[model samples]
Target: MLRNSKSGYGWIAITFHWTMALLIIGMLSLGLYMHQLPQTEPATFQLFQLHKSIGFVVLTLAVLRLFWRLINPSPRLPDGMPPLEKAAAHLGHAGLYALIFALPVTGWFMVSASPWGIPTILFNVLPVPHLHVPAALGSQEEAESFFKLLHEYGAYLLIALITVHVAAALKHHFISRDDTLNRMISAAPGKTDN
Candidate 1:
């Protein structure tokens, strides 16, 4: 059995991790910039549509990652980790999972409520159906508007959480001199779900 630390991250896990990270960075930057634009602007609508489409892809990938984790289980942290560090690691991971799942959900709900409707962007060549929500509370506009706010704020929270996560990883890798960073990067060949 190859040692976990020296094994390195499975190709799939590394692929997913890097790809999702890059995508999130793009989505967050674009989403924030696009939000600053006037709602009445034609480009604003298209920007939002692109954001929603990307969000859906992120959501799908998150679900698959969760499923992969459940099936394959993550490698254990380096032995003899301090209690506090372990706890922090746990919290960081949990927060990541929460944000990953929450982001797309909020986005989806907002798109559903959006009167303009969401557009699919498959390789920038497809238009997927807008997942619409049922009218129940009052006017569709009012509901969608409310959900849009939730989605927007949720994005900010996600960005903050990601910032914290990356900082912690750096701390572990450099300041603490711990295996925390290595563990994620060295999960054995083919063990990664990404």
Candidate 2:
């Protein structure tokens, strides 16, 4: 059964939270490891392709999640939290939402600008067309360098934001022994009036 929180998050919100958490962790790992590979290796290109594909999937899921959040609502903070902590939590979540949107857009542009052409998926069977013409973007070297820097720096920012988020979650769950983590993880819904 769905438990109710003071702010009113239910099953849908919890489901989105946990699912995104897993996907984001996988993406962060992939992004970091791929960047470490030598640029000269064929495997580096393969990893980059995989990274783009995974990023597109994350973008789709994130859009759905954001739409769902807009239609529904998030749970309220625990009543006893300090104003500072509450403000921090709110800012942290906002930062997460912003990054979730930005990362995929940048990734898509990066791929689109590559001279080698970008691959696409339509359902499980059809391939879509690449959106950008490589000639229009620039020389191969320029396109590659520009998008690589965008992707790499964007990734670093995302990593920092996620690190702070994870730390905050841990602090809430373990140190504070609050329902912040439990609001998403517990099998039961919090105290719902209805």
Candidate 3:
């Protein structure tokens, strides 16, 4: 199933959800791990490059996933939910989506604004150029510091949001006893319902 149905997610959405989940979680873990390592080590530099590569990949995937969501309808929230709860759910989801895009863009901006002039070679293969910043942003140092803070704090926000998302899903599945989680994990056999 390529498109989403009224009841459940299609293959594409499910794939995007799981793949991006893994990548985002992995990226967050990597970031925390790298923070503890001595920056002068060669391995630390390599890890930073790898982190940048994954950030770009996440950005690309986020673009596609968002496009898909724009075109396809998402599975509806449980019918029994209260109006206030539903609104909260929607707002929470909005936050999640916002972080998804903001984190990567901020990371890219941070790297581009760095004074070191380090070229971002994606996966050490493809050369990703830095963003050409106008003088209006002041010195590169200030801009880099600004974006770096955004990226770092954005990561922490993402983690907190993900916790809420997962808890809500589990609540829907276990407490609510609905097919909410199941529908996302797998569609009914021969089901066109996304």
Top model number, TM-score: 3
Better of 1 and 3 by lDDT: 3
> lDDT values of the candidates?
0.72, 0.74, 0.88
Candidate 2 worst ten-residue window by lDDT: 185-194
Lowest summed-lDDT stretch of 10 residues in model 1?
A: 1-10
User: Measured by C-alpha RMSD in angstroms, how accurate is candidate 3?
Assistant: 2.1
Q: Quick one: ranking by TM-score, best first?
A: 3, 2, 1
Give the alpha carbon lDDT tens digit for every residue of 8-126 in model 1.
44556666787899898999899889979998888897787777778878988999877765655366655667889778878877878888888787666666676765455755776
Model 3: runs farther than 4 Å from truth?
Answer: 189-194
Better of 2 and 3 by lDDT: 3
On lDDT, the leading prediction is 3
Clashing residue pair totals per candidate (backbone < 3 A): 6, 6, 3
lDDT comparing candidate 3 with the true structure = 0.88
After superposing candidate 2 on the true structure, give the runs of residues whose Cα lies further than 4 Å from its correct spot: 1-8, 39-43, 121-126, 132-144, 191-194
- Residues 1-102 of candidate 3 have per-residue lDDT tens digits of 778877778889989999999999999999999989999999999999999999999999999999999999877777788999899899998998899899
Question: Candidate 1: misplaced stretches above 4 Å?
Answer: 1-8, 118-125, 132-136, 186-194
- lDDT for residue 194 in candidate 1, whole number 0-100: 29
